[model samples]
Target: MREWINLPELGMIGLRAKIDTGASTSCLHASDIQPFQRDGEDWVRFTAHLGTLVQRRHRCEAPLVTVKNIKSSTGHVQSRYVIRTDMTLGDRMWPVEFTLTCRKTMRYRVLLGSKALVTGQLVVNPALTYVQDKPVLLDISGAP
Candidate 1:
């Protein structure tokens, strides 16, 4: 898998993602985050920024897995909401946990960390971008 990723479940495709081996967990940029209880389960509502050029926006909701204090690249620690979802890169698809926070100032909205890399499944070429063919945007009008 290349650095970029496709999150079909989240209505995101061909999205540029930063591969950070030093980080233990992945994270996604989200805005207007709101938490609520749904059917006795913790749920969160947020919006994801998709694509680079076109910059599409999608509203998403997921069950909150946990709250974690993540150290940012600048070494600042902040609490974020973690949610599990499937991420597709190349021909592989797997469940990954993504901490949700406002990353509006970051270069890329998605960050793929060590946990999502798995064991011996991916090789990162720091000098490369979009090693795999970009994914076509799927109709996620029905997605939740």
Candidate 2:
């Protein structure tokens, strides 16, 4: 299922997503990823590129969740940085963990994997696209 989602905590909205039931973990497209410490806790900062034709870039920072080795569909395994953040789909909101990686070649910047679906109790119709309304962007001062 393809849908629009929101990362309110990240101040991102109306991001297109591929809700992949085959994927075990969700992922976000990111670049210039840098790890740093904040108040003695691990954190990560990166640039999240949005849109396909008219691209928009947003700088985001989140607390480090963990590093995990994920096997891609192309049979490549890589250690990726993970972060937990609130994701909004439809009218539901919940915390979802996402692996940050370079997905410039992908059609979607957000990949909603099986874990998110199960947690969100989402049932994909496969034939459906944009089943949920385009999420409203938060009126945040620094939102892009």
lDDT, residue 133, candidate 1: 75
| Candidate 2, 1-144: lDDT as tens digits | 799899989989889999899999999999999999999999999999999888999999999999999998899999999999999999899999999999999888899999999999988898879988887654558463
Q: Give the Cα error of residue 70 in candidate 1, in Å.
A: 0.7
Q: Which candidate is the best by lDDT?
A: 2
Please give the clash total of every predicted structure, in order.
0, 0
Between which residue pairs do clashes occur in model 1?
A: none
lDDT of each: 0.83, 0.92
- Model 2: per-residue Cα lDDT at residue 140: 50
| TM-score for each candidate, following the candidate numbering | 0.86, 0.94
- Top model number, TM-score: 2
